[model samples]
Target: MINYNPKEWFTFIFRFHKADTFRKLFPLMIAVSLYGFILAYLELEYWSLINSSYVKNLSLMHSVLGFVISLLLVFRTNTAYDRWWEGRKQWGALVNVSRNLSIKLAGYLEDESDRLYLSKLIPLYARTLRGHLRANVNSDEISDLVEIDKTHIPNQIALRISGRIFELHKQHKISSEQLIILTKDIDVFTDVCGACERIKNTPIPFSYNVFIKKFIFFYVMTLPIGWVFSFGYFVVPIVVFVLYVFASLELIAEEIEDPFGSDANDLPLDTMCNNIEKHVKEILN
Candidate 1:
């Protein structure tokens, strides 16, 4: 995600990041401005709707619909943010589990070879999961760690890790108590994977998303039609500003709703995965 100091208000106002909604919506804003201007010119110079009560009353309709649209946008933005935050929490849990597993194995395994094997495998699971979430699983990473099914890479890695712990238990390398402790951490690896998949696979309902977009479109399109009587040509900028605000909210919601993707607003999976590797190495090595 694009990191910045929240305190720097001027920097944010003066600068436009590539992912800024303003940049994405600028073309549409220009089109809406021109459309508003055309409607205003036609009404003032030709139709003479300024004196008509019917045209003037349309603003009241907008005022009521404006409240309804605001509520929808609020719900939309909140729902999207909840998904993003949940994904971050899952990754945070994964980091802790990786550390716990590494620490336990380091204490339980006396053989340098076994510790070395886990040192590589623990971090590889994080990297594998990163790739899995992005839907670009790299078999080479898993192959380097262990030979297992590539169909479900994260599950395979978790299984491999569990198998090693079980093998150690059978050989009396670790006691029953140590095996239980390590199994708890190992089980969470799959749990975290399943949680991330849930967030990535499921999304807000289709009808709801389409309804909000339609509401914004029709609302902004009609703004210049009604207000042209009072504001005349100035309705052009007014309509464009309203469109900018409403459209920007939808764009932001879309970007953040799928937090695993490459969007600037997505959760920082790359950095988190690197940290997992670093922490695991420190504890196991």
Candidate 2:
């Protein structure tokens, strides 16, 4: 995620330089713009050729449709923001739950060795979660965080962690009663995982996505035509610039809505997980 700090105007713009990665695919934008321009030209040309009374009627309809599409875009942006914020809040909850689990394990396990074993496991779970959330389970950072023996940590490391937790419980390293208590806390983590996964895997429905895309194009298409009588060639850059603003904002909201992806705008899951490890270990140490 972009650091949440005050930035100079130039710096703020520079921060989004990475957004250029997406801008390279200008074909889609070009296609849309050409379609818009053609539609605008046809509207004006057809009206001039026909000299029908419908020109005034079409102007009224265009105004009404423009207002409606603007409202829909605003609503769409708000809904996307809500999803992104909720996903981030869930991870915030996970951080708390992980800390609580560590404290509970420390309190419940009597033997120092048992406590230490549980302590290590707690951070490993956090690391595992970070990797799994980002779909980087076999990553070196996760492996290093968990300190899994080379022989034991297989390619399917996520499954390995789950299995080992059960083994630890069954071996009486952690009592069944304690396991029951721990599982509740684990369930909180599980809920966080499920929620994040849901956001990552599911997007706004196809209909909603299609509607928004169509609306933005329809809105921008009308923009240059509406201003062309006054702005002429200036209409070209103005329309593109305005559309870029909306597109950039929409792109960011879309990126953050998933929160678990590798995008720069995604929630800092690895950083959060590492912070959890450091905090928990500090408590134990």
Best by TM-score: 1
Give candidate 1's whole-model lDDT: 0.89
Q: What are the lDDT figures for the candidates, one per model?
A: 0.89, 0.65
Across residues 1-285, which tens digit of lDDT does each residue of candidate 2 receive? Answer: 766567466666655355453464356567656665664566455534234454334446556876776677677778777877888898899789768877876665556765565556666666666666666665565544355555323223434434555777777767788777766776676677677777777888889888777777766766755554444445566666657766655666566667676677777877887888887777654
After superposing candidate 2, which stretches have Cα over 4 Å from the reference? 7-16, 20-62, 139-180
lDDT of 1 by residue, 34-56 (tens): 89988898899988788899989
Residue 72 CA displacement from its true place in model 1, Å: 0.4
**On a 0 to 100 scale, what is the lDDT of residue 88 in model 1?**
92
